[model samples]
Target chain A: MSWRDGIVLSLRSVVRRPARTALTIAAVALGTGLLVALASIAVIAETRVIAQLGKGGPATAITVDANVVDPAQIDSDTPRLGTAKPINAETLRSVKQLPHVSTVTTVQSQDVYVLPPPIGSALSGYTGDDPDRGLARPYSDSAIGIDFKQANNLPITVLAGRLPAEGSTSEVAVTLGYFDHVHLDPNKPAAVLGQVIEIGSPQVSPDGQTIRGRWSRGVIIGVVAQDLGSGGLVTSSTLTNAQRAWQLAGGDGNSFGLPLPASTYSSLVVVADSLDTIHTVRSEITALGFATTAPEHLIASVQRYLQVVDMVLGAIGVIALLIAALGITNALLAAVRERRREIGVLKAIGAHDRDVLRWFLVEALICGVSGGLIGTAFGIATIAVVSHIVNDYLVSQGLLGVDLGGAPVATSLIGVAGAAVLALIAAAWPALRAARLPAREAVGAL
Target chain B: MLGSDAVARGVAVSVRGLQHEYGRGRHAVPVLRGLDFDIEAGSHVALQGPSGAGKSTLLSLLGGLEPIREGEIWIGETRLRGLRRGELAEYRSRVIGFVFQHFGLLDVLTARENVMLALSLAGIPLQQRMRRADEILDDVGLTDRAGHRPQQLSGGEQQRVAIARALSSRPHLLLADEPTGNLDEESAERVLDVLERLRVDNGCTLVVVTHNPMVAARATHRLHLREGRLAPELVGEPA
Candidate 1:
């Protein structure tokens, strides 16, 4: 008999036995729905994390920390604090010469107050003499230090006037946030160019390890783009003079109660020529006793973790499906036994054993497909309800991520197909038994 | 083995020294002890026997449903003993049709579907099945009851449906076992009438296992099975 005939025969049987078919479908649906729901959650989680990590920062930008050792632990050599080798001019020089290191700039912070702090300024609501107190300063907010001679090392884009010319120690640049700190309109960065500004002395330590000096003056020759993190104090080409002025203002190595072996950078921002070179460059920098971090690297780590969880969850779903397949086997074997006479009639009427097998397998196939579709719809609906509950919870808790929908169609389809294939496998033995049924006994069976 | 006489005038079904047993090893019980028999082509033959006399076994052997463990069963020029399982199935589907005593109709299928299924099993093309099924249903006077399932039809009508299914493919050999045993007297006569008339019209050989004398009376020839051996055949005109 043709497979179509077999399928039609199988369909008639399915229609005849509604309760049995419904129970089989329900078993399959339970497994498939569980799988789809778990898979959708995984998809949403992955999408959320990836989107979060993909911010304005490009993946090619690697931030190199001065310390490789974990800061959360204290070493015996430093009784009270964790310590690691610092990034200095020597290491910076070596990094700049590395292959594919397109650009590298060291950022340093300045803790100084503008004399007669401007009114309604960052110095607002504070009366403390200690610079480290809640009292805020203009340059304290945007640590300014860059090698203005190199285009790649410019801490900020020159918004008006110009960056300091090479070897020009008297000229300085400030960020838009510095203007905000001084209570000046941020839009007026250009108006302050060429105006002389005095930086007050930083507070000295009680241990006499630091010495306070008189205020230092520099001409603001340039304004840089961005709200913060542009150079607020000095230029790298004129490093010694700037350091001498900062030291005179009591901003020496021992000023902040932390002993520095030498002048150290706060951090280094390294830019690779392209995405392909970023990893190698980061690894090379890390080998030099510095911690390396990049947006793409963090994303890769999260993805690795998420993949394991997805596999684990998917495996649980598969186990459920396997159990469902067992149900199929049980139901179909019973069918074969109960329908022995029917089988006999078919054979007596000239039906081949293979035709009998095909009919039973077609019945199983129907259950698998119908159950899979219903389960998928159920899963999508479950995801919707789950998303609503979860998103509502998140909103109440004031967390990121808006609405969670989009249940990866391709993965769901593959899962449904897999379940159906498994059902076919489960039905094979029963189908074979039916197909090999003897016409003699089957025809005579009551 | 067949005698030299089989070449002289061929028979529709020829059996010689056939031996069949059931179970296996210690539990194996012999059912049909050496039996030899023949039925003419285009004739209706009734196989009358006591219960457990191996009448159905003999019919199954002749129709190639069971393997010939000892002797030979020949349908036309083909030997049933040496045929492979697949070949035997083909032989049964193409060369022979069977009607069981219980009116072995698929309960899930309608009367027309039952007959159509038989035609399908006989390897009829898909396009001709509907017309062929309708023709067979009409022949059995089941045209109005074609849409009724086995449970919905009376025993007489169900038996006619089974008979229609057996004849639908027009197999060269028809082997029926107690086809009308479950039906009443009136239904039994109608079933016998259809079998006998279709037997001559289709020109296919027919052999039936039956306990009813009335069933045996409709056959052109008669044979009795006693103690797993066939009695001498009796010649008669179907009445």
Candidate 2:
């Protein structure tokens, strides 16, 4: 029979068994929907990260370090300074002078203490200097650092006041928790922003000896209102002020020797001119003996993880699709049996064997295509449901700095195409059964 | 004016020394033994017999739906007994029309659609199959019922659609197995009239197998079958 007639006839036949058709369609939808949802999460996660990284700088950029070496042993050699190295200003200056260096900055974190009866008897408040200021208070007992300009580029949002000036030794910024711990009276005009506070050094060394260190007093210029919960803190200043404070806090010469070698910052943020330049810049930096990468590379790494996840998900989905296909095959075979007397009648009336074969095959194709369309729609709705949960988790955890709706375009397209392929795959066995039926045998089937 | 040789020369279907047996060895049940017949083109014939006389089986062999066990059966130049399965199918599509007692119109299709399927399977062009389907339905008195599916039509109407489908390809021969066996007298006469007119209009050789004497009486000739062998031919009243 002509393809059109075959299609029409087949469609009509499928429509006759409404419940069976609906069940098959639902089966496809379940598989496709789960696949689409999982895929969308992966895409959204990648999108959020890349957006953050891109905001921080260009795509092709690198940080250079003279003391760059394996990080695993840096702690054993230097004692537990709490996990990150203080990259020296001289090293940063040298890299700043390197060719194609768009911008360069330095930061370091160290411990300090804040005095005055501790809030709720739980040790609170951070006393630290900007890495560029090098002002250290050994008494206050908190994380302190000279914040690089890059810190302002951080994904964290500021709640109140303003950023500390480029070279201001008279100011400091504290997270919202820092203010909470000090028990400072917010109603008192002088207790909140612009409040002058005395900062002191910590009580003892890692060896447990109470000893004197450096101290400084500065006004609070900005308060980061986020409750980061991780207790990470930052402070910043100009390069010259940082040098003076370093000298005051026992740093010697441009090469400050530590109990171990002072290597480099724990992580580096670099910006390249464009997406295309990221690879070239990364390779160039790698040649210079530094590990380097960009947002897309990190994204690719995440995608590799997603690929494994998808395989597991797809395997699960395929089983469901297969079950649906078997159902369709069963129904079609049943149709063949029930229609046997009719088949005999047709053959008796000049209907050829091929006519019967074509009729049944057309029926199968109709089921496949219809099920595919239904499944695709279901998958998109599924993605929407799952993405809501995933996005909420990300926002609540601060992983995603902002809420993004649904998923990217490519992710949705992949879902639809995948469903269509699955439907066609499921139709093969039934189509074969239909195409091979002999007129005599088929007529006898009943 | 015509002798048996002239009549045999005019035959659209000829079967000689036909034999059919089921199974093998000790279990072989002979179904047909040495049957012979010549049906002239444009003539209507009815085969009458008891249930086990192999009326259906003989019709099947004659229509090229089954292989012959022995001897020869020919429809025009295409050898029904000697042809391969594919060639036989092609022959059937081009030369034979069939109407079963149960009226085998596809239940899912409208009357017009059922007729179109036959023309389509015969390799008629897409545009022409529809028109031919319409014409055949009209000729079978099913024009007013074109849009009705098999279940929606009466038994007589369903059988009419079946006849339309069978003849839509304009086959050279019509093979009916009790075309009126399932119908009441009024419906049977109506169906028989349609079949007679179709045979005349198409110059088709028509064969009907039935136990109904009235149906047999309308045939141009009658063949009495007893256990698959044809009795001496009997002249029947014309339709």
**DockQ by candidate, in order:** 0.40, 0.34
Model 2 agreement with the true structure over A92-146: per-residue lDDT tens digits: 5544554444454443433444432222122224233423432332223233344
The structural similarity of chain B in model 1 to the true chain B, as TM-score, is 0.92
Full-model lDDT for every candidate: 0.71, 0.61
Q: Candidates' TM-scores? A: 0.67, 0.70
Q: Write the per-residue lDDT of candidate 1 for residues A197-235, one digit (tens) a residue.
A: 656445454554654534656577776552113345544
Query: Lowest summed-lDDT stretch of 10 residues in model 1 chain B?
Result: B230-239
lDDT of the structure predicted as candidate 2: 0.61
